[model samples]
Target: MALLPSTRAITSSAQALDLIPIVNSITSLLQALNPRNPNPKNLSSSPLNRFSPFLDPNLVTIVITKQTNPFHALFFFNWASNPNPNPKNYTHSLRCYEAITNLLLHHSLFYPAINLLKKSQKLSDFFIGKIIKAYGDEGNIKAAIFWFNQAKAIEKDKYLYSFNSILGVLVKANTIDLLRTLFDNVVKEGGFQPDVSSYTILIRGLCKKGMIESAQKVFDEMPCKPNSFTFNTLINGFCKKGDMESARGKVDEAKTVMSEMWLNGVKANAATHLNILKGLCIAGRSAEAIEYFRWMASCNMDLDAKSYIVVVNEYCKLRKIDEAVSLLNGMCGRGISLNVISFNSLFRTLVELNELHRAILLLLQMPQIGCSPNYVSYCTVVCSLCRTEGRMREAGYLVDDMLRNGIGLDATMYGCLLEGYSEAGNEEMAMQVFKEMIGKSYVIGLESFSVFVKMLCSKGMIVKAENFFEDICRTFPAVERDGYRKILDEHQQITQGSIKEHQGEESS
Candidate 1:
């Protein structure tokens, strides 16, 4: 006896229910609908398409109203909102905002999902606070403020996001007047309570902008006691401004706050120590800075390259070249690599002391230590070579090394070589360098060309100097031609006077 058609269909539907869950296990499958995908053809024959009749809005509304497990209903609603296939009637049909908002209202990932929606330009200003909070978390207060302004422009009713975002950005930017204006506007408009983070950012900004008294007033007037981040920010700000007394006071306040019920978890770190050391160094308190650097080392805080470079620069500036070198050598011994800035500092000091050979040696070590000489480093060594006796060959070798290393030789390098040759009484070599400079299309500014011309005129080669001057005028059309004309007139006067004097002497 064969089964009836209706009985066969009921049994088939029961079997299909077991396969539906397996098919729906794929998460966020809508992302596969991108036009770039090559396989929408595969989805055309999918079993999921057979359930299309059950995905109507009325069915979804019934599920939402009658289902005991709202989670499953919510998932269905989300899927209904973001349909599997574009409707044959419409070009675009996905309700991205409705789906995201539904997820936001019911999901654990409310903030992140809202942010994803905002990034897609699908979220509205109703979620502005959440968006602002997201931006603040990412340290993008400026972007937060921009979006807040956009929201305000779109809708006249100001929200908390508008106040907080503007205040946060102004505080971060340290625009005191802008922050005050925003604060006053928020207060006048009413119903916006400034958070601790807002106050902390403002206090930090004020102290950073050198308004310690104003910062203190804000600190004192806060509704709640200050947290460690607040105190730490102020302390760091004071340290940056070289106000050690205020910095110490803030440190004490941070200690007090940490001991109390609040535990702000923000204590002084390497940045704080480094800032204090810099302030000390600037005040000519090298001994104290060195002591602090040592103390930080004792605490196992790894000193950054800039910290070492700053101390090295201070030593060099004070004419303590040996001390600078010793510090650099000590840093190298400790497996702390020197950066290009530090290496260049030491090289410059050695060059200043007329120790060209030692400077050259240090320069060679630069590549081994992963420090490459920038333009300043090359210029420094070249200038030192030009000044030192019998270093012309070395200077030429340095120039070759620069070219080999792919470091460009600009007008300064050419100028240095030209001046060196002129000073050495090698006028022909100088002319050759000038020609090379022109051939290479280097920017030979008026000052360098004028120097070269003066060198030629001094050697009684007035015609060559005039020709060089004319070539320069042609190259730089915007340059005032009067300066070059003056040089030409002077050369002519000198030449004519010399010839007349010679003729008179011969006649006599």
Candidate 2:
């Protein structure tokens, strides 16, 4: 449990420099180190002997944390644990144990975790909560409760860890009522003190269950100040419940907290602004959301991609394609990496407005923007091109592009293509598409079938249409057959009326 001596950090440097890259390099070496060393205590026999000069607690912890293979992590942990290159012998710190133990438990390496904890004299009640939470994370509430009870019998005053872990377990299980009962009992007993985490878990449960008022009450009653996470939770809960007035109130409170944090020289979590943007969007005040987003962009708050996408989606929903594109271009100018969601928003809006030309251009330009067009991007424009007259050729090109890109078509895309072809009087292409659909067992829906039959009859292909119907209509579901019969019957009536008009013209 003693601090491992840093790499002759015993000595000083002339100027301050970043050693993180060097530490990362050493960690990579340890991660790639073989676990089956014949001499586990000696680093000179292995490739890591070179890094012994750089070995420190920080590097050791990083090495253990980075290894996905627990046995490999254990090997490095063992090799680092040995007293080497130092007259003042030191061992792995408690923080190293936490890092390794967490990694082991994350991978369900329980037996090894227990062994490490016991060997390091860390197998105590304080560490038991981690085990409890691990079970809860895997959705095993019963096992979590068992551990909680085990901790319960050991120490009365130090049961707070077990209590907080159980609260989180109950929250995950959606057992809000039982969690509240336990919370109430704990408070009444007053055997232990509950920390910010305890209150946050209870508030999270209440918020999830739509008990916002109760969550707020707990927030107001909390002895400790709420963290950003606590405020974000309450704000999100109100937003989910469509109580933006309350959400905005919390957002204002969060702003004040952020201001105080700023004055205190604490960097505010950039997500604070993101929560406000989402709340504004949920309240249908997208204009305000856009304004807020622009303000965040201008500031040094350092918001992430999601903040831009949220505003981009809002702009799309408002049919403000120009503003959305402008925001995206601005993001590109700032060297912010964009995902397909940013481009897809534009594609979808353009398609909705019958702007296939613009949509197609955007789809092609996606790769140029350093982002690949996803299925939604191609499907949106391709489906729109199919809807417009004389655009099926372009749709086919896009479909070929999709095939080249290895994107498979879903039934929705197929049906949309069929509808688009039928509506454009491209019956030959429609029929070929139908043949493929039939081969794939993709049944044509009522709307697309009606469009197909109408296109056939309107083009004077009556006999071919009749034969196609008599054969295919029977194969359709009985309900769809009935609907098709009515459609055929109405078209027949219209055709007979047209024949009578032709005869009257001859008589005249």
The candidate scoring highest on TM-score is 2
lDDT of 2 by residue, 239-317 (tens): 5535667665555554554565466454556666677688778777778888888788778677778888999999999
TM-score for all predictions?
Answer: 0.65, 0.72
Model 2 per-residue lDDT at 235: 58
Tens-digit per-residue lDDT, 103-188, candidate 1: 44443444545554655565555566555555655566666777777776655564655555556666665578877777767656
lDDT of 1 at 182: 70
Q: Give me the displacement of residue 359 in model 2, in angstroms.
A: 1.6
- List of clashing residue pairs for candidate 1: none
User: Per model, how many backbone clashes are there?
Assistant: 0, 0
Model 1 misses residue 411 by how many Å?
A: 2.6
Which ranges of candidate 2 are over 4 A from the true structure?
Answer: 1-123, 235-267, 457-508
Candidate 2 lDDT at 93 equals 83
